[model samples]
Target: MEHRDVGILHPGAMGARVAAQAVTTGAAVWWLPQGRSAASRERARAYGLRSAAGIRELAATCEVVLSVCPPAAALDVAGQVAAAGFRGVYVDANAVSPERMAEITGVFEGGAVTVVDGGITGPPPREPGRTRLYLSGDDTAVARVWALFDGTALTPVALAGPVGRASALKLSFAAYNKISYAVAAHACALADGHGVLDDLLELAQLMLPGTPLAELEHLAAAGPRAWRWGPEMSEIAQACRGVGAPSGFAEAAAATFGRWEAHKDDPAVTGQRLIADLVQGSSSST
Candidate 1:
């Protein structure tokens, strides 16, 4: 279970940071370059990650593989690793529901790979105490994975349960955190459409003096990332129903996020522009 070489599948923003942290810990980090973008290649280079020709090479070479892709790709990534005959530790650190986590776990069933569920809370860790990676699985495997992250910016905490627990915790946390942002954006959009946005802002400031209008920033930031969040919201809705809770809010949040598909990742879009566009879209749709 001692992994000296770690492979990070598809080093996006969060994956790159995780690789950088592993590099700082002197672990040889590897990434697959096949089908990856130039931006991803540059990121791997900047993080000092070694490249493998493909998934098979990566799975064969590394002792541990960190699957940090989007939630939708989690199962496929696991399948790739499993098919590569990877017999080492596999960590899935995506934002997915417990049910999806269980499904991903099932992918590695009958394989030598030990599946560890990971839920990363907070943003990419740039400093100590900024984020935590919650791991749940077999005791020995979880400990091994936790040791890999020891002393890194991304603090790893071993959860006292099986694989799905970590993902359940992650989905539960994100359900509220992200859905609240969607609600705030929709509220602002409604206010803007009704010509009471300024009035609402003033009222909020007067009623809640210490709170800043972060919803505006959230909406602007969400424009590019809404595509991802839409699925995440749906997963959250599933998580809600799995726990016997009402899922109407999360379903609505998913629909609201879906409306932002047109502006997905548009750097030119501003918060005001996002709000106006969302309001206009709502108006036109009706």
Candidate 2:
């Protein structure tokens, strides 16, 4: 299949790798360097992505543009694309509530652009079997997006529904996947309070054999990304409430993740530090 030109909205950690996969497929992946940090420019360069002069150029040039930034900026990114007269397929692959996803779709209503709903599960595609990208929308558009990563490390699955299905699936899965990490972190805190944290984790491994809870390192690593996950947990809560499901756990998980937001991208965040932040309801780093 002939690959089309693709534009990645922002080349952060996940977006850069995703763009690299598109590049590997012989597609020209573009990113706008204006207003991006030095790290983003370096990542884009490392991934072999072509640089667009600006958002307007990116919007007008690429046949497809994928938005992989923070959930809070999804709408704004869509608005910018819409305002810039982008008439191609726009894939929103951010972690967001279905309602928010619909809002993003609505941004392109009556426009020439085709909005595709996408939800990326798992981490950045460093290797096979670690990440999956869920897409739902017009079958042809989904197929087009699917083909972009068909042979890459990131697996793309087309859902059998409308625009919101992919986002709903993403938030639903994340509600459990991420909140469980928060729960385990708290468990670590509780156990440590009584001087039995290691023993508790030992037992936790038996109960959650294949899960991240089975290892303290996994839970510790979760803390540094709390800045990203906190908003996602809130989005999960909003998603649950939209579907008439209980949202208390998701809401609490959001708050729990907030306590560790100060540790965003900090490599030094440890299991004990996460517990301390939770126990104090704030990060000591603050």
Candidate 3:
């Protein structure tokens, strides 16, 4: 069930990551930018991706199309797929809600292209790691879609039923994971302020890996680097609101991340550096 070609719309971090995976899995990968972001352009250059002149070109050329654009761009890309008369499975793996997934599904209704509602969990496969990609469109091409990720970090799960379940699961998972990161960030910062970050770390370790202290350390230590997570936390906060859930921690930490973003581009700084400051700064100056 190998795809002859795979096209990635939006060569952003996640998109590029997935594209790298697809190509590594032996799919002849092509890509088009969502827009012109310098980082994305650099990634495309690094990966040697064949650029599609436009959506129509990509839609006409590829057999497997994956929409990894931003959550806001999800519907637009789906519409483009429909308009271009795409002739393959379009996996909508944006971080959008269930309602949005259904809307995208409608965009491809009765079209030659089949739409699979997919939510990608975890970062792009940098190594041979596995991140479950929950799929729920009930499309017959799901098995083929699964094959696309067979040797990659993605394990595609075709969840039985409607198209929104995978998106729902994604939102739910993001909500919890974002909250967990928020809690860890807050706790570690507070403990650092109280001059007990080391003690707190020790206490966190006693939980025998169940606690996310290690992850917290990574996030905190990667301070400027963690700024990339800012928008994601904000999106997670939005997801909770859309479903009547409390997103306090995510919201608060997102604000904290906002402060970090302000200095993310500093010559001598990174999210990790700021996190280290928060974790080890002097009490009086902290």
lDDT to native, each model: 0.83, 0.89, 0.71
Q: Report the lDDT tens digits of candidate 2 across residue range 123-240.
A: 8998888899999999999999999999899999999989999999998888878899988887888888899988987887888786656787788888778888988988888998
TM-score of 3: 0.77
Residue-level lDDT of model 3, residues 96-210, one tens digit each, is 7776777888888888877788888876767665577888765677777787777677677789887778888887787676556556766767777778877877787776365
- Candidate 2: pairs in clash: none
Error of 2 at 51 (Å): 1.2
RMSD of model 2, in Å?
1.6
Q: In candidate 1, what are the lDDT values of residues 160-235, reduced to their tens digit?
A: 9898899889888888777776777777878888899888777867775433244455457767777778888888
The positional error of residue 138 in candidate 3, measured at the CA in angstroms, is 2.5
The candidate maximizing TM-score is: 2
Comparison by TM-score, 1 against 2, better one: 2
Error of 1 at 231 (Å): 1.2
Q: C-alpha displacement of 118 in model 1, angstroms?
A: 0.2
Give the count of colliding residue pairs in each prediction: 1, 0, 9
Q: Where is model 2 poorest over a 10-residue stretch in terms of lDDT?
A: 208-217
Query: Model 3: which residue pairs collide?
Result: 221-272, 222-271, 222-272, 223-271, 223-272, 224-270, 224-271, 224-272, 225-271
